[model samples]
Target chain A: MDTAQFNEALAHIRRFETMLVEDGALILKFWLHLSKKEQYKRLKKLEKNPHTRRSVSKRDWRHAKLYDQFVKTAEQAIRQTDSGEAPWLLVEATDWRYRDLTVARTVLESLAKHLSLESAQSEITTQSKPLTPTGTLPSTLTILDTVDLSQCLRAQEYSQALETYQGQLHRLAWAAYEQKCSTIIVFEGWDAGGKGGAIRRMTQAMDARLYRVISTAAPTDEERVHHYLWRFWRHIPRAGRVTIYDRSWYGRVLVERVEGFAKEKEWQRAYLEINDFEEQFAKHGNVVIKFWIHVSQDEQLRRFQEREKIPYKKHKITDEDWRNREKWDVADLLVKKMAQLPEQTKN
Target chain B: MDTAQFNEALAHIRRFETMLVEDGALILKFWLHLSKKEQYKRLKKLEKNPHTRRSVSKRDWRHAKLYDQFVKTAEQAIRQTDSGEAPWLLVEATDWRYRDLTVARTVLESLAKHLSLESAQSEITTQSKPLTPTGTLPSTLTILDTVDLSQCLRAQEYSQALETYQGQLHRLAWAAYEQKCSTIIVFEGWDAGGKGGAIRRMTQAMDARLYRVISTAAPTDEERVHHYLWRFWRHIPRAGRVTIYDRSWYGRVLVERVEGFAKEKEWQRAYLEINDFEEQFAKHGNVVIKFWIHVSQDEQLRRFQEREKIPYKKHKITDEDWRNREKWDVADLLVKKMAQLPEQTKN
Candidate 1:
């Protein structure tokens, strides 16, 4: 058989499930089990019978010889893929009648359960109040509204403070490295919120070798294929190093949530997931610093106009920035909700 | 001082080496040490003088209490950053004059050595034969060229064999998960060599949740800012999962080497780096499988044309594929060299 045709056939089998179930997909799997003695007995019978002789090939005997390897491999696969939505049923195949009966019964049970679920869902849709998108948090006051965005620094004062902090950060970076401690600095802000300037100031003070500034952009095709958090996990700094995110996983709740890019349930669950992710960093004794750079709407507008006038900075101002600005109120509310979550879950 | 100005001051103090030295960078560091009693006496003197009083802030007094922490952090930094090219010199600062003299003498000595080495390099260039690229391996026959591309599978046989192998692979994947063993499969082949087909066949048989197929492309901005291999290191599968690389870190030698994307020296040293990386995976008990799918030039051309005729597959055949084909011989030779490196370095 040509490899291409074989691969095509394999593709056909795979189309049953192109991706893992993000929600639930009904899938039934059965594993037939036979003792070595029983397998050997069956093999001999197949070889003797003309109708089944073709099925008992030299490869079959070779596989039987490596039965232990097969068993171990099967056990691992079953364990990894076993979940509430999709499960494997191990059947004793020594007796064909028993194996068939057990498989048939299991399939019927699953079908009945699935039918009941479908009917129940329909009944609920007709009988209950329309369901809101899953994962919406209650509206409440948040730290965001309390921030004093009107606060401004004089040029001389800004310069002096920048130098002081940069110096401290440099020394602290070296200290952290010496102690084999890693650091993750997250910057979340509005458009033209001076994230770029602040990150530049920080990087300028540290040894380029000890820190990396990860400018988060749209997810790549490979990243888009995996869990949302997988991309962030891939970039965690090693011991004693620093990774500064220009924007970060908060996008799942911020941009992704406000823009409706992520389902309500996905963003809702993200609070717990993000908290868990941060806890792992804390457990590893990494310094985790998060900064929310805030700016007033008028100041943001001024910066946008200034960026447009400066040829070099024009690219930084985009249609998306304007679009995001329009939904600032929604983003503000969501961010406030997110901020409260960490404090609640901190213990 | 405002925070900005403080940060600017901090940046000024951080003019020391900011990043790790990828190549040798001339650097000199001095660790000035003073006895605790001497430090206390100096602090008292500074406090008495109004001019020096401004330099000694409340933070300085706070830091004095954690002198041990400072010492430990400094020691660690020195240890980690110490290399033959950029060594740290410890100087006793009990007397300011002695510390200054020691540092000055060390700097002079290092400068003299560097000058002499620079002259020696010029002389060598004039007197000796041209230097070969560093880390060039000896030419040797490898498994790559020995593959018989003409060996083909019939359609019926291919279908049957694929089913058998996919079944085995499916089972093995599960077993690996149960045993908490991760797997890494690397695919490197000629354009249109059916790598995608083979990978699909393997993935089809296993659960999507158990494995990830990473299609390597040009590095992202974040990836570009770090070491070339850092991106690959970020994606290593956790225990009980499988990661398949469509193209991998081997690109340093293959594409980067052939296309001049990497310097001659950088690609040359990658063989050892790659060996070390694989050894780490092996030590972690990962099942590593590498495939070099062989196909004749005629077959490759045929497939390329076939892809062009199919609307969905047309995008797969790009101008780059045609260009890459022009350098097939170079890639083949480089690959052969790379294949032999693992065997030599296994010990």
Candidate 2:
């Protein structure tokens, strides 16, 4: 909000404007803002609500007090940087009705600017769309929801299949490297549902020279200071390389939203922010694959017990898991909401 | 070494062993290995006389040839996966004596032992060793002797100085990107001078973010085929960084040398055997900068004229500038010898 910070933000916006002019790509940013009183009240209500009481932490309450300063800073930053080419749309998150409507309108506007409604209609006419035939696009069974344990291989067979897949990935990686093509794969699912295990297996076959595995954790100090998208931008592979994200930017919507780690406004605006990020990746000629490993609550509990018993793996079991479990119904509702999101809306 | 097939001759050494399990601190690597023919020639020639035919391409002949394959492969790979703990060393290019001596001594000695040298040394000596003044250390000017520039500005005039620097660099660059915490600067210099204008102004007001600039040209195609680094490994910055190079690894030693690109034996060892590559950057953290801007002899003449164009600039142009001009006579003599190196060694 100071003069120097404002100028720096303006310079960044100008650079993006130049890119938009040259590349024919429009840049859109959204701010999800919640007032301090509203945020505190929401947390207080959550703590008092018997069903959701345990999920509200002392730390979260502390953050809620400083929510005013956070919003003020965000407002000034947006005002200073917003321009004709890329303007910031602020979402009022105190009311869900206002929030979702604002998001849908902003998205429709940006999409319209990128691809006019007339053009979209013409494209739709040209493109064949799929029909939901019976179980083809099941409402009850998602790609995550259908991860059957019975279909999994025995230990020996698992190793063999893993080796084969790893080899395939490795050769594919080398081919990509030799051809200077880049690839990005995203893994997301229920915690402890073999996401890391599957990733380790996939990486095993790659030529140490061709691929990298990036694990996303809590935002670092530097990462917290920048836009949420900024940290993800740093990992895009150069020509002829591959990058794998264990958990990805979707945390902004998933854990951050359901767990109250991010403000309602921030997570609410993330759908479009994420879509924009993926759009950029596609434009950059990267082959992107997203996998969501779904595990049932029963399976999650079994793994949680296993982690507690194992000495080395004990560190991975955090108090957060127990807390998240307390609001499984809410998390489930959010995940279902995320699942229903149109493919084009949030890649 | 035929004109049509000149690039293929860059294949020289096959596999490069660049890693070692050394004392705890992973020492970075730069391997400068020379073949027996080249080694014998140097030992025999040096024994007979102090002066041997100095070839321009010969300086990087071996590096360029070996660079193409190994360096590129190595750079593309994440080294930690290959060896669980130890980091690989990037072997740099040099004469046979230097290459062999470094490998046999520093690299091997560091690799074989698990002892922490620093801690052990500290334990042995209660007080740190004081610097004993040698009869005389090499003058600071010799280190900077390669630079050829007319002017420099001080920190007090930073705004004007920054404007000039940014303007000159913007004009010089073909492409630019600002990634999080990394900036890459690339420069291509001549055999000696012509690098001053770019290097002299680059280091001022550098950010804590890792900034690296690589200069490239004239390595064997064999060097070309392997890893991208088969030539530039020694210069990568590990953390928040900045690196500048005098000359980079493009030599499969041909353009000015015989065989049109580089001779058979002289530049033969580089192609598929280079060790430095993309993986290093992909796996590690740093911003990469690569530049190759060289002045022609005529431009050199103009620049020298301009240097002495005013009384204030007269001090900038020196006898060394004239001496380097004279060295090109020696340069041509060396070029002839380089033209014959490949056939002489291989045959």
Candidate 3:
């Protein structure tokens, strides 16, 4: 899409009122129009007036010359978006008074019509629920059930396997650097499921200078200023390097969803947003690896009890961990529903 | 040491002129004094004045009550630091004009004496070298000679050895984390000396989230605003994490020294400063590891040639690399001399 078309589409998508229009909500848009001659005359007047001269620039004249092109694109946008629930009102802006009056009349007329329709609908179905449809997940079964919690590796076998994998990973990491390929590994798991241990196993085989481990925690003041994903984007590895994330953006769907930290609509829309984000990574030819270390509820409890007896490990087991355990089933259900999201989102 | 004695020692050490006092340089020191009653009287006057009210605070009043203690410490500092060349000129600061006049006269007298001495010395030693002594290294031999370049590992042995070490490092890293011990690893080496390779081996065994590799390059505008060491200090890993430096602050003494980027005296004094810096790390129970990869001149040349023939590696072989190779002997001599510094400095 051209710049103008893209900007118009972005504006539409960003406006919550525009989205609501699709659900039969009233939304009236006004397009103020001025002819090329009228725009140039106004520009000249602005330049001549000392009060407005500072606001005028060379770019103003430059864009004025392309007024026809802008009008064509804007007209196309209006036609495409014009609908019964969200109608566009075109007002000729050559005269300020006429433009203002037309815009005011259009808004008042739309509001009156919407109010009348709402009143009639309320009278006809006073006992019925509102007809807003909520989107449903594709699956209800928790993916946690599929994990074989009983699976365990003997200490000796685990050591041997770790050695083999580390050796291979060491070589592969160098090859990746030589080939200018970047890799990102994401670790998300249940409490005390050995995510840190597994991550350590992979990093042990790589060069200290070639990878960075980002342990996600509460967002800093600077991070909170931007979109939630901005912090993650800022740490994306440079070419031929690796970035490993502990926990990750999935908290928006998992913990945030279960804890009601995010609104229902916000978490529901995050699935598509996350998919688009990962799609960009795939497009950039980055290798994305994700792991969910699964462990049984009994094992987690046993570990927590064991941690309480160890001085160094005691801090890792907190009252908050115990509180979170109480909501395991709720989290489990939400996670399973999230698992039904397209696998492509994990990339 | 008490605060007053500490400041006196700090001032003496920080001033190059003070150090040169033994060499017959004329140095003047100043110690401003005010009685407890006089200071409190002035502070009250300042507080009552609108122009100085902004500077007054509860802390100032609290400190005012300690005026007698401060006076005792100041007198002790002045007596301890009294020297023939850099004599302390104590001025009663209760009266501003008297204090200013005393300071000005002291500086003027010292400057006159210094000028006359310099003129006399120049006349007497027209052909003789100055008596200032330069600190010399203990030896002229390059430490590179101590490295056995003939050392090599076969492919199979290298793989097996790498796995064993990686496993050990992995466990140690976790232990360090649990114990809240930070680790710093410094890498320095000749071109094609496999610094990157060795670093990769060590990092591969670590958890990706527990370590960060910092590759030093030219300082950015922000970095240039602070001391050269500030950049390195800013990246020091938090508790339980590892920070690996590809090259480090040693550049102030190494590359900057040989390349004439730093003055002779600057690099000369860096030894003590760096020693103190590393001593702090040791005191904090942080593990510090340093490595210097050694490669024979012939081996480096062969590797450079090999890199030039490989498509991906060719970019690593540049004209700058060739130029640096030409100064190998000079760099080798300087590096060996630096190695003679106390072992604590290396850590």
Q: Pick the candidate with the highest TM-score.
A: 1
Query: How well is each residue in B6-85 modelled by candidate 1, as lDDT tens digits?
Result: 45433432322322233234678788897766777888898897534544678888878788877976775666656665
Clashing pairs in 3: A200-B207, A203-B204, A204-B204, A204-B205, A204-B206, A205-B204, A205-B205, A206-B204, A207-B200, A213-B209
Q: How close is candidate 3 to the true structure, as a TM-score?
A: 0.39
lDDT scores of the candidates, listed in order: 0.76, 0.58, 0.76
lDDT of 2 by residue, B117-193 (tens): 55675576443222122312232323123445455567779868777776655423312223333333445444334
In candidate 2 chain B, what residue range of length 10 has the lowest lDDT sum? Answer: B6-15
Q: Which stretches of candidate 1 lie over 4 Å from their true place?
A: A1-347, B1-82, B85-142, B342-347
Q: What is the TM-score of chain B alone in each candidate?
A: 0.64, 0.33, 0.65
DockQ versus reference, model 1: 0.02
Model 3, position B24: C-alpha lDDT score? 46
List, residue by residue over A1-347, the lDDT tens digit for candidate 1: 46564454444333323223332346788999998888888999988965446456799999998888789767866665566666789999988899999999999999899878877865654322222334345667778778877678999999899888888887778778779999999999988999999899889998887998898899876677677877888889989999999999999988887766776566666776677678667755677889999888898999999998999999999998887888777777777877886462242
TM-score of each candidate structure, all chains considered together: 0.43, 0.38, 0.39
For model 2 the local lDDT of residue A19 reads 44
Q: What share of the true interface contacts does each candidate keep?
A: 0.00, 0.00, 0.00
For model 3, residues B1-347, the per-residue Cα lDDT tens digits are 67765875545444434445533456678888777788788889978975446457899999888887777776776776676766888788988999999899889988988889888966764332211213244445555567776788899998998898888888788778779999999999888888888888888888887899999987765576556677898889899999999989888887787676665655667776666666667657798888888888899999999999999999888998898898786677677877777677333
Largest lDDT belongs to which candidate?
1
- Model 3 TM-score (B-chain only): 0.65
Q: Which candidate is the best by DockQ?
A: 1
